[model samples]
Target: MTHEVTDNRQNDSTLASSAFEHQMFKESTATRTSETEMDIRDRLTIKGGHVEGQEQVFTEGAMSLLELLCKQFASQVPQLLSNRVKKQALIDAGELPNFLPQTRAIRDGDWQIRGIPQDLTDRRVEITGPVERKMIINALNANVKVFMADFEDSLAPSWNKVVEGQINLRDAVRGEIEYTSPETGKHYRLNDSPAVLICRVRGLHLLEKHVEFDASSIPASLFDFALYFYNNYRQLLTKGSGPYFYLPKLESHEEARWWAKVFAFVEDRFCLQPGTIKCTCLIETLPAVFEMEEILYELRSNIVALNCGRWDYIFSYIKTLKNHPDRILPDRQAVTMDKSFLSAYSRLLVKTCHKRGALAMGGMAAFIPAKESEMNREVLEKVRRDKELEARNGHDGTWVAHPGLADTAMGIFNEYIGEDHVNQLHITRDVDAPIHARDLLLPCEGERSEAGMRVNIRIALQYIESWINGNGCVPIYGLMEDAATAEISRTSIWQWIKHEQKLSNGALVTNVLFKEMLVEELANVKLEVGAERFTHGSFTQAAVLLEKITTSDELVDFLTLPGYEMLTGQFG
Candidate 1:
């Protein structure tokens, strides 16, 4: 049974009624004095059950820090989320986002972000994965410059997973982390030299449902950032790296400003300098592309790079233009980064970041190596071409989902940025190729197909099933699919249905058509996974959810929102 903390505890009420009555409760709390402990415990409640090592990760000091973060910044998250809604309303009304006229002075002005840390300077190849113990060891030991330990898209936020991830990261930072295979008794540990570690927290819109303060759940970003920083900042600094982070799914400069403020607040709490906490923000949304300069400016003291999060950016494009009939996207496979909108977005990001002396990081290479020799070669070549384009286009580095692709990406980036140059900040495109608003919003050129639609349905169904079953990263059809890719898959179908798109087969997309396809695709998914695995999996629940979100009256903002609710069995 799921356990939860309740507000109506007799002791809780008694403590709130009188400080003297709380004196007894205070002594029972951990860390600091009774008065301080009471104050912290009274406001914050941990509803998550005790996972292994939870005591170490959720210490009283850490909980106090978490409480402080919630009190200080949780209120700001709602407004930022509201700001996103308002902007989307305008976009729905045809007021497409443009470069902010008010911030043009900042964009045109000559200023750069603070100097990046030496360890982060040559991030030619970075690998990312969920913070599972063995995966963390493998990723850190992978031959890459950096490893992004993801608690966002790549992680399913089961209480145990979240708690254990912190424990793994804590040990990883101290070089004490290891894992042994239960079946084979094979031990795994980090190599003598490991990649620089960076953490990716959840976006502003997510809530840590297991934690509550003032009768409301805490923002997952604050929850994640606060715990990780409190536990590891000193160790990281001692080891010549600070609390480096990757901020995900931000949609505006105002959201960037909020993160900047949070960084400042945490720094002040620890009496560290303002720039001690560095970050690389993902330019993954349509609106963020328009505010690249302003975002860099807001976090000028703390940011080092801006990444082109291609998959989420595609989802954002479809989402931002869901109501625009003329902007309905083609099949998921057709909307590659080479399209005008994505290309423009990437070019503008490189231009904006390079002008600000920040590393312009490229998007992910999500292809998983096929088992067959010939198919694996094809995968490598495709990744080679992708990284080659990014490198030639002025990106300093790129992301690979697997360790196998790291060397390929490294070779491409090394060829572009030779040994003399740590980054491509010297590469600028302002003079020759200027990007305009239309270029960023231009509709993708391709044809939709019934086959593509069926693929989307199958992928979304299986991915959502895996996610609700506590796995966020899955290899589906030779690609490492995460929340971002699944978002594109599902949202594209929703958009197609909303616009009644015509596939290449001359079949019109409708609710009926989607349902028919979904039923057929579910059978295909079952056969693909086999009867035993399909029976044990959450495909039934997944099918119900996929149907709900894809065939809803309006396009769902995020399928994970609903999926999270299912995971916790806590509905609004």
Candidate 2:
């Protein structure tokens, strides 16, 4: 049987208007049913407790049967069950009828197993911060839909910071926060606007070490902390009105289920309604990848969206593919959109989310242009193109490292989302066909040797130089394009920066700033390579070596773009 295509977009307005209507229907039905059941129970009680019975003899077997009948009748009405038991039953059944109160069924369509509104998809920007209060206020003012105050990877390993993060969350929810300017240090109370604040808690794997200061002991203290903060904050926040949380680094669907249970427990203790607290998981780890569908199913109603963790993903890939020398990532440039594995994984993620009727967001393209120059212009252009490609490839949204890049990202989204072929609807006869990533990489003939690395490096440097000079568009060899090429170039530069660069503080080059600093490094490499001579090499060999260096330079330029400045600001 063929399913009807009901335009979800058109139904959104009707759904909003019918919210109160649905509520009335449920309340009326529940009230009338309760009254009828109570009437029957009262009659039963009266009949069971007769005046003769009070005086003396009632048959024990008859009384037992009467009691049994009453119990059976009561059990038939689900509303008679304790809220906890009802909720548990619903969860076990992989449904969330109680949470919605309006939607009778858990599954909406083929894609969405949960009854959550796709309103999360309407939210454009996600602002993250190390400090909860500050980030929350900024996001609210910025009018971004999701504000993630991070306590995990962005924060350091300090007990005080953890306590502070929790306290800030409490304060923000209470609307008692005072925003202070970082530059002027002037403080003011913010009570008017509140964005949907979501906390990125420390990953479960790091809980033991973080709380106990030892890997062996599970951080039981931390669990208490979570319980206390979440319970109190849910109550305080709901006093006015606010959204839920964004859970990061979940390893399995069971973990998500556990979190949902934790949420329910906290909500019940705090007298908050079920589903008041919502969650979205970040698909960062390898385990999380395999369990994506199950996790989404488990958190059906409360789970809103999912994001890819690119850096962590890269780290995982390296660890997993360590045994294969051929798969070694020599430079960050080698890990471009061109990489077969990454592209394939991205496509799978997009398809999976869409299939489940959830928003599939692209990972961070941390291109922030530093300083107002031609290089910055080139960087922005490249970032715009990359974001466009992400949107075109079925991703609802993509991440940007910097706030300055936000406008460009939005603009790219607008330009592409409305285009004919870009947003064209495809009617498929079969629903099981697979979607693949678009072919973005060009064919290149080069030896997969150290010489190939050299060519990549040179290309990355040239791209960076063009970016810094304010060339909005640049041509490499005969290829004419905007910053997408520059971004690929920046990736190559990141590889060299990661391995070869040193900081003034003696810390390793890891952040976005270090990436931007690679332009100069690429130039230096170019000079060094010029002094060397290859006396006897074939045309293919020489071409291959040059391509490697050029690719490297292009990557460096990409990182140095203006869009990356926003990412640096996040860390700073």
Candidate 3:
């Protein structure tokens, strides 16, 4: 049966409104610097000032692939994002998201994603971290089924970092990665064996200003994915782990369709088998949640798994429904996977994937076992229970934020899926996630406490400082935080303030109160990190930047958007 296409809302509304972004980013087929065997060079436009490692990053062939991908698909990014805004507008106007009337046919279409690769068949434990060399080495060596070397949320994309990350990934793929820790004087290298590697590029909404295609900045997703694939596809294939990916933040099946096309073209270009590339789509947004079957149907041939990105999913829930007074979330701590809405989403994910002959992966166990303290031990126990829930509910695997928690998650999966078996095809229990779209809008209830406010302020300040220092993932309050946690921390405070939310302590959360609390936390963070480090670090600017983004009249979608401009020294 042929599936009917019903993304008319896309064609009629948002796609038509994104002319400005497209006209600005038309692709150029010219040469930059010079072409050389030592380095692939080509013609390109650079709006941002020269990036230190840009030269090595844009080696001729790699840059060529990036240019081509942008030319073909970058024009479509703005519309996808705008579609999100339009849906948000509808939600604000009192219409909540439901399964698309047009796509119901597609959702019920008879199809399944191709079987996962052998190396990925048993992804019982996956570790994720930034693209920095030592972190990449550690993650790959962490004895998990897969290591997602991230160029997106877990990374602050400084020009040097972006290029250097590509180089590091190349080296890691060839088993030549080596790094010596500066502070500890400790050497880092891969273990005798490394986990299967999968790379997560930036979302479609992000832009790479350092490198322009025609006269405008290209989509960072294309830039990151193209560079990695152009440089290392063959190497990965030769090593028996085919080109694998974790596609993040897709809002619609149309976006998924675009990604599927790219995979097909790249496979043809490299003369690899048609389904050589595999992707695991992250259902992190409310809109994407409604389109799960359609998303998998769109990319069925090369898709292997679907993961529940719980934190960002929660943030997306808030962001998409910001204007609904009835939907304002409570404290971040109050929300957990066990909530009816999140649990419903999880069960639906497992049922959707398993029915389609694909793997339904679990969410991140962000609680890191830190310092062996009592609190840390308790968090570890919580992490163990979380993984067990996933295993019991038919999730094929789970993710851990730290290597220390790997064994804990791994043991749970082994109990259910067998030490030698993965893909969780044996679990045949019927999951009862009979959730409606409104249930996805779980009511936000709990004390908007002064304590919660303090936690937000302190974590945001520390996270931004780390981000400014080029570190995206940091352990704080026993949870492994990357850009997503930091975004949630700040945005929650902003949303709370916008609503003048009353705390459990009876104080109203206002802008005035938030700023006062922020100042105190900034000072506290400075004292905690010591005078010299704080003085030299990006603490002051980070504090200012954090305040500006959070307190503005407009709610920014991703903190990284503004933060990226600051990192590359660019502005509106």
Best by TM-score: 1
Q: Clash pairs of candidate 3?
A: 31-42, 31-43, 32-42, 32-43, 40-59, 40-60, 41-60
Q: Could you give candidate 3's per-residue lDDT for residues 266-288 as a string of tens digits?
A: 76655455567789999999889
lDDT (Cα, tens digit) per residue for candidate 2, span 37-96:
444442332211122212211233222323333333323223312333443344334431
Reference-based TM-score, model 2: 0.54
Tens-place lDDT per residue, model 1, 284-397, is 999988999889888887899999999999999999988999888888888877887888888888888887778999999999899999999999999999999898889999
Clashes of each: 0, 61, 7
- Which lDDT values do the candidates have, in the order given? 0.87, 0.47, 0.80
Candidate 1 clashes: the total is 0
TM-score (C-alpha, index-matched) for candidate 1: 0.93
Sorted by lDDT (best first), the order is: 1, 3, 2
TM-score of each predicted structure versus truth: 0.93, 0.54, 0.90
CA deviation > 4 Å runs, candidate 1: 1-41, 570-572
Rank all candidate structures by their TM-score, best first, as comma-separated numbers.
1, 3, 2
